[model samples]
Target: MLEDHRMSDISVAVLCREAGVSRTYYYHHFQSYADIIYQENIMSVVQYMRQLPDQGIITTTTMFTRYFELAAQSRDTQLTLVKVGLESSLIHSFESAFEYLVKNDLVVKAHPSRIGKKYWTEFLAGAVVNMAVRWLQTGMGETPAQMGRFVSNFVGLTE
Candidate 1:
């Protein structure tokens, strides 16, 4: 229904009626219909990230390919989330994903216990997200693979 009448005069009331649900129930299932948009967006991101071999190299190339595919599929949703100012948990979600890669030893950190002999993980981690945010803004001239390699190289995280 949202797909059919998203830009039309059809409204929340009409959606509720058409779906055979109360306004409360409709709203309850989602924080307004738009919430479904973002939730789907996040789930897609999570699923794409999940596909990389957990026990193998989750290289910059791999990261780039997956993320790039995700961005292409849901650019609007990603743009909205990135621009909306990330929630702490949202940022943490990225952190956790990287951590998983680290644990699987797929990321090949300079030092698993202490990369480059320092807790440079924070710096390394931030760089990925920072670059991603930049991509969100300008997307500049970089392909997702290129951007991924750039980020991976920056942190010395080799495949």
Candidate 2:
């Protein structure tokens, strides 16, 4: 699996053989390795986020803590994602996911600033995803709880 090898070192043949599936089956389910990775990680997070209570106060700290906790649970997958040069794709996925939350009113507005809702959500998503990428790049020295607090504080996203 990915635990023992770099993503670049694993080809479709190796993956299909290990999973006991044909190349056709693999192609039927996924476009590529990156697609599998994206679905398994980012999509799971998005699905979790979608289930969050849309009617609550949902503190920024709570939101981020849950986010980072989920990310931490998938630490290896995330690191591999960055290692495979999919950081931009990861960012795009998170941004799009965040936009979905906004459109669905799953999250409260951080502030009533001059910024438009769409741009404001983009700004927030960009900041959070950038922090996550940096955290992964620098070895994730901080715990998920710590990261949650740090990001919330840094963004002035207090309660």
Candidate 3:
């Protein structure tokens, strides 16, 4: 429903009707419309990240590319989310997911100081999310691979 209508314009009734679900069911599962949208965005990123191999500079590039690809595919929804102040929730979701990778030792050979690691994790996640949002806002003039390389290089992810 978010893809079909602006976030500001969508109501619970309209969404429930369009989704063919009862308002009770929707309310039972989602706290609000923003929650549903946030969960959807987070799940999409999580699913893509799960398909990637363990973390490394190359893997980071792949992750960014996949994120951009998803954003490009769901440009309208992303734009609406941004417009409705839900972009931070989406970014926080990504940040938490990336932090999980780091905490689980999936990030091979990343030996930064504890404080540095925390800062870098937040920085990288924010960069990727902001860049993806910008790309979508600008009509995604660059291909995913192109933006991927640009991000990788910008972050000095190359060996």
| Reference-based lDDT, each prediction | 0.60, 0.71, 0.74
- TM-score of every model? 0.59, 0.73, 0.76
As a TM-score, model 3 comes out at: 0.76
Model 1 lDDT, full chain set? 0.60
Indicate whether candidate 1 or candidate 3 has the larger TM-score. 3
lDDT per residue, candidate 1, 51-152, as tens digits?
Answer: 776766655567655665555555555556555443332345555666666666666554455554454545554666566666766855677777767766
Model 3, 37-81: lDDT tens digits are 678867876776766665443355676677677778778877877
Stretches of candidate 2 above 4 Å error? 1-9, 50-57, 112-123, 136-143
Q: For candidate 1, what's the RMSD?
A: 5.8
Model 2, residue 83: what's the lDDT? 69
TM-score: model 2 vs. ground truth: 0.73
List the candidates ranked by lDDT, beginning with the highest: 3, 2, 1
Prediction 1 TM-score vs. true: 0.59
